[model samples]
Target: MSLTRRGFLVGLPLLLAACSTRTTTTSTVSMISAYGPIADDRFPLPGLNARLIQPHLRRQEVDYESSHAKGSLVVDTPNKYLYYILGNNRAIRYGVGVGREGLALRGNAYVGRKAEWPSWTPTPNMLRRDPEANGPYRNGVPGGPNNPLGARALYLYRNGNDTMFRIHGTNQPQSIGLAMSSGCIRMLNHDIIDLYERVSSGARVLVIQA
Candidate 1:
């Protein structure tokens, strides 16, 4: 039942073709099932509309051969895929929305901290560039389903300094696979919660831009 990265890549087209025939109800059920259950105290996350996301962007396990040790987070930015290395040449991949145009960054960082339903504040530079979009958040926005930073956030740091970047959930699930954020890596609410549970503080994160 398991496939290697090469096998997965080779068979992906056929797999997607099979999935295309699944009933809407079946797809909905599968999507909901992927999320398991939510805790009562947590913010309610909406079900992802499968139509809004590309097939490759959906969360799945695949054979991933990586030089990084198991448990490291590797982000293939150009491909818009984030891989949580599981060793044995395997990983759990999730679709992501990354920085658009000039906001992208290339570097190595670590998860300095993490938060569930974390508050968000716009950086001074962000405010200066587009006050209308980043202005209201000057005082910080409380975490919620409607918040831009969706369900969870993994703050990225480098050499003990905050990089001010994040691997966070997005309110805009449709944005998955697009380069459309200020700089933070954005994931679906369901995807992020899964990642948040798996990632720990100080986990190595490699952002491969090429």
Candidate 2:
């Protein structure tokens, strides 16, 4: 499929209840489809021109050790790196697209929830800033390969309230290593999926000012 600047976003089941011989039960369940490998064609294949990821300067030292701090997510906005703190000092670091100059932030938060193939609802702020992006998409865009959230989302909350930002996947892989998103941290689909699998709800996330 052709890559659209707005695409790259891509998501359930139910259960019933019954009783024994003469009984009746009712239940509700949802199933998650096992996601397949992200097709190379679905993304801009790895190439020299593609945005570089986990570049040397941003990587923790090769011999980095995993500390108790492992399993953390670090957003080094200045360097455009998001590190998935692996146990010991090592981490799987990925390049990210952060907010622009005036939009950058410094703070700490945690992942309050995680979603695969997440739907997106442009915030009121977003709609006010981009009227053309308004209209039917205001409430929320359904999750799909064409969603701007790419393939996943890890919602960030501070003091248990949504910061309205996320550590999420991006279809704009080219935007990685740059500042382009609307204050959310954007990662490659493969990278976010990998990190998503490793992190859990309530994982500590630190966004250090670069």
Candidate 3:
């Protein structure tokens, strides 16, 4: 639960413990306090301008209507929202930026692996689509503030094979709530860090196609 790297959650779905959630109705946690500058991180991060983000796009606990088990994740692609189902009809909602029109992942998958400040390398497809943009990073980028993967990454898998899809933090915080990624979902640095702690490696995920 500490933001440490976790091995690929091999074998059964429940290989890791269920994630604990915060759902107290009287909780006093505020937006500024949660999204403030993170100076103590390995690579210090600047505070986000919450005012620039739409209220609905900000991270918050909400009354979720879902039949999925607690700890399951649901990505509402069209709405640009990711729901961390905590059951009891509640969930923590975070804004997400998804892949463009035909590039989003769909159906079921699970967190096969989780990493803090994970390394990032462009795929062949990415290179082909925009060599001028991705060619430079073909050698890959080390994990850091400037890294495209940002502070954390959750690798998605299906049938025990890495699907090459991810739910990760991004250096472009402004991209949240937009459709501009390759195929993986993108979250804010602080939000993904918060999620990385709460979600276990084997947590199930469902990405609803747009």
- The best candidate in terms of lDDT: 3
- Give TM per candidate: 0.83, 0.70, 0.85
Ranking by lDDT: 3, 1, 2
The prediction achieving the highest TM-score against the true structure is: 3
lDDT of each: 0.75, 0.63, 0.80
Clashing pairs for model 2 are 9-144, 10-144, 10-145, 17-25, 65-88, 65-89, 66-87, 66-88, 66-89, 67-88
Clashing pairs in 1: none
**Global Cα lDDT for candidate 2:** 0.63
In model 3, residue pairs whose N, Cα or C atoms come closer than 3 Å (at least 3 residues apart or on different chains), thus clashing, are: none
Off by over 4 Å in 1: 1-32, 35-41
Give a tens-digit lDDT track for model 1, residues 121-208. 9998799989998887899989998889998999999989999999999888888899989989999887888788788899999887
Q: Residue 71 deviation, candidate 2, in Å?
A: 0.7
